[model samples]
Target: MHVEEVFVKARFFRALVVAVSALASSAGFAGEVQVAVAANFTAPVQAIAADFEKDTGNKVVASFGATGQFYAQIKNGAPFEVFLAADDSTPAKLETEGMTVRGSRFTYATGALALWSAKDGYVDSNGDVLKKNEFTHLAIANPKTAPYGLAATQALDKLGLAQAVAPKIVEGQNISQAQQFIATGNAELGFVALSQIYKNGKITSGSAWIVPASLHEPIKQDAVILNKGKDNPVAKQFIDYLKGPKAAAVIKSYGYQL
Candidate 1:
């Protein structure tokens, strides 16, 4: 080849190599963050994840389940970069146990409970349906593993119906499942996250009584960066994103308090 042609080819090859390297770097920083989210926060988290992806070019892979289950999975090294728990205690425990990045836990949202029935007119604003004791079954999350479930139990006890309604109570593995029981007619009525039955500050479907927050302790949903994600920039970004205005707006719209 002519000397001039050889020089031109060398310059072009170097440019091509630099371009490829730049693209690879971008792809590396835009990698996915694995997140474990409590079932009750599923809808709001999904919305936040979508917006985060669009804005930052980073991806989020979320697993929705009971917070206790996620805690177990994380202890077993489940590769989750972050955990969004339905209660504050779980994340604090993880932090104390060195399972999460130190000082990384924070309350992301405060969830509300509601007494809901798929059948129209079955539930009232005051939750008198529980006192009437007419429903064949009531669904609630398993109090052992789900914060919402614990809250449901508290509310029932506060209403003086815990013992009276024991036989008719059906337990779901998670809040999502409890909601499903009510949705699919497996249970005539149930206590669920207000977020599950409400959107835009209103109940979208079904009859519901917004459970008074006074009925139980605050369901302070917490988020933390797991130990495996301490060094992950994207995971840190995601945790920060959860505390930002964008995510807070979505959480509020879903009937949660930021």
Candidate 2:
């Protein structure tokens, strides 16, 4: 009612509005982020994306493929705002090539390799099935592009069966396709990500020999905000969400190490 009281109230309301706007800009994001995710991380990442949308009202559009392919696409100026690579090397390369925001790279997960079969009991715990040579076709992702494929090659070489099984190998463009090959019986068995066959802290179906971590290099998966996403609040928030407790739990449930 008094002039001084009215002036003080108006100033307080303006300050509150400014504070709320700043908070929205910082955390209350509103945009769809375009993400390039590695094929092996498809399931868990989808789950994480769903949680992020539910919690933050930010949408994520993910494209799953080989890390190497994603790297090439990013280098060529693809519109992806985020890169979730199957291996740290690809993201490091992109950083070196200036395709991503500097100092934005971080390891998100460590993946394990698995020798898997769609048929129950087809693959043994110790992977003796490979030594038996009972199967005609085997599937693997493209070693040049997929990190899991490279790990599979290493495992075969370690077992001294690379030369023997070379002829029966069926290569997929990405790990997801390789999984399809085995799941549909096009191949009797295949090398795939442990996450692909694991669920709820155990193998959900079929059988798998989780390749020893010592047999191959560690699959340190990394995530980076691409140059296109440097200014995207939702993109940055998505990366943060992946490192948060909820997303990490989902990732672990799929057998990936964070």
Candidate 3:
């Protein structure tokens, strides 16, 4: 009831308001972040994005496709604010061309390859199914454009089945399509990213042979803030969220190694 009490209460309220405003600014205003995601990362990124939205109050707008196609789109001035590439080289190329924020690039995952079939138990352990060469059709992404496709080819070569399997190969424009080929039975089997059909520490469907790391060049996937996203706080925030434990866990759940 005293003047001093009233003044103290008013000062407390003003200080509380200032603190709240500062906290909101630091937390960042809620905004939609547009990200171009690699096809192999579709499931993982979707899970991570959901957690990111819940944690940061920012919406993630993700477009999933082949990395090379997305790179071409970026060069042609796509509206994507962030790029999650299937290979490190593409992001590095963008950085060289000044398409990304300086020092914003980092490897987010080391991709693993899998030999899979829509048929249960069709792909034997250790990937000897490729050597059998009995399948009517085998699906693979375009090696020139999809890094996973390149890895698939290398795996076949290492298994010494490239020449024999050449006649049976059917190609997809990207990994997702390659997977679809097998899923729809258009191809008997296919090589796909392990993440595509794996989750929760197991294969989600059919059967798969996880290609050994020594079969081909390591697939180092990277993420970077694109030029359009450099000034967007939500973009940076999303990337930061991806680097956190929550994102890492989701990525791991999808069979990707962080």
Candidate 4:
């Protein structure tokens, strides 16, 4: 009789442990949110996510891509709960299409454009760098897909160098890729996001000049919670965290204007 009682108790304990483990797993699943982010905002978004995770105990899984690509994915039923776009157009279109929750969109940051070169003594801040014919290759994002590339084109045109530099230009699919082309020395110079070179309150290495805003239309980045995320408390919390002071500090540190 005693042996039979011991077996029953053991079985009961095993069942209890299994039930508790399942509950823990469910809770963890509830605490995660997925985000679609723009490549230009990658650095700041990472910093913001770290703070958000600490404060809310929620995990954010972010996918970075060009704003237009992200918009297409969201329309095709991508699982993202929120989007941080490189410009206002994508988010606004999502709103019009009812892909995003109405009134859930807001301007998150203003991006800065730069003429950057990884090689020393290659870029001049006074806008005279293009006057020289020494560079063999120049890089910019595909203007049709990437907002930064369009801004770069505008800046070149305003400086009267577009016609001269067009033949030398190599285009990347996105701003981050454009940065990579220059960073890897595949291209001698490129127009890229200022955030890539600015970190920890300074421009550490490489040479760049922040292009004047007057050279192009403003790059106003926007963020939105998708309609699919409307009822997700974790998604709402993440959005709030982005608008909080901690995220703002990170954004400013990365050479973005909030």
Candidate 5:
């Protein structure tokens, strides 16, 4: 009888130990945060996520796409905890609709537009390349969906080159796809995010004219904690970390203007 009682107690204690261990593992996994990011900001955000993970000891998984698409997904119940948008408008709309934490939004970066070509010596720095009509296909993101595309159109319009360049334009669904068009030679030249061209702290194998901000409306990128992230401690920390100097340095290194 004594032996049986001891065995029963041992079994119960072992089960308790296993339960506690499982809880601990679950807590550790919950510390990771998922982020939805605008495609144009992918490069910089990837660098920032690395720094954020190092600083906070938390994991960050980012999905890149057009802001408009992300907005739709979040509304339909995506599991993303944070959103980094290519423009302020969408974030503002999310806030107004109470889909994000109140007052948790801020502009993280100002994006720059660039005319890029994979072929060396193809792009002219003086912005006259468009005037020459030398390229048969020019790529731009879908203006109706991507903020960068709208900025590109505004720039062309401001320069009085819109009509001249319209026929040559090939539209990609997002900035990253547009970059692929130029990078893969599907298009001779494309308007891409400056972050794509400025790799490793320098322009990579392309001549580009960084379109002046005056030529178009500002491309103010904003970050917000989604309503889904309200209960997530790690998500809140990651959002705050993006405003810190560590993340700022990484963002600037990718040619984003903070």
Candidate 6:
């Protein structure tokens, strides 16, 4: 090869190498973050995680369950990098226990309680079905571990139906299972997160009376980075993405308030 041609090739090769390095650095090596998500926020988190993975070229490994269970798991050193809790208190409790990153906790969504049934027109809009007491069984999460379950009991208490409805109650370990009971006809009707059966400004299927927020305590969903995720950049990115406009739109579509 001619000397001039050799020089030109060397320069071009160096430029190519530099360009590749820059591209790789900008994109980074695709990393994955393990996230523990609350059961009620399942749909919204799945939607948001899809967008997050698409936009950032990262993977979100999410496990959905009740917030209190997740809290216990985290305390026992579950390998979760982030937590999306159904209520603000679990994250706060984790923060206090040094299980999470400091100042990383924030409310992600405000959930609504819903009285839902898989059968069409089975649940009245005003939630008179609870008062009517006509169903063979009613489903609720175990109030001891699920915030939605606590909210359900609170609403029952407010309506003076706690004792009357206690006998026929069937309990699920988590809100998702409680919903499954209704969906699979294991129970005629149940209390579930509004987001579970709601979408695009309405219930997705069956009948639901959106339990008035005034009937129970506000369901403030929160998120935080766990100690396991303290050094993971993707953990912060996921939370930041959730706090952005795109994720907020998805959350709202599922009947959650930001």
Tell me each candidate's TM-score. 0.91, 0.88, 0.88, 0.90, 0.89, 0.90
Summarize candidate 2's per-residue lDDT along 152-253 as a digit string, tens digits: 999899889999999999999999999999999999999999999999889987889999999899999999999999998888899889989999899989
Is 1 or 5 the stronger prediction by TM-score? 1
Full candidate order by TM-score, most accurate first: 1, 4, 6, 5, 2, 3
lDDT of 3 by residue, 84-154 (tens): 99999999999999999998999999999999999999999978888878889999999988999999999
Q: Which stretches of model 3 miss by more than 4 angstroms?
A: 1-29
RMSD of each: 3.0, 6.4, 5.8, 2.6, 3.8, 3.8
Candidates 5 and 6 compared: the better one by lDDT is 6
Name the candidate, 1 or 3, with the larger lDDT value. Answer: 1
Report lDDT (CA) for all predictions. Answer: 0.93, 0.93, 0.93, 0.89, 0.90, 0.93
Tell me the spans in candidate 1 whose CA falls farther than 4 Å from its real position: 1-28
Model 4, global lDDT: 0.89
Q: Least accurate stretch of 10 residues (summed lDDT) in model 3?
A: 24-33
- Clashes in each model (backbone N, CA, C under 3 Å)? 0, 0, 0, 0, 0, 0
Q: Could you tell which candidate, 2 or 4, scores higher by lDDT?
A: 2
Comparison by lDDT, 1 against 5, better one: 1
What stretches of model 2 exceed 4 Å from their correct place? 1-29
Off by over 4 Å in 4: 1-30
Which residue pairs collide, candidate 6? none
Worst 10 residues of 1 by lDDT: 23-32
Query: Residue by residue across 58-138, what tens digits does model 5's lDDT show?
Result: 889999999998999999999999999999999999999989998899999998899889988888887788889888999
Q: What would the per-residue lDDT of candidate 1 be over residues 107-176, giving only the tens digit for each residue? A: 9999999999998888987888899998899999999999999999999999899999999999999999
Worst 10 residues of 2 by lDDT: 23-32
lDDT of 6 at 136: 91
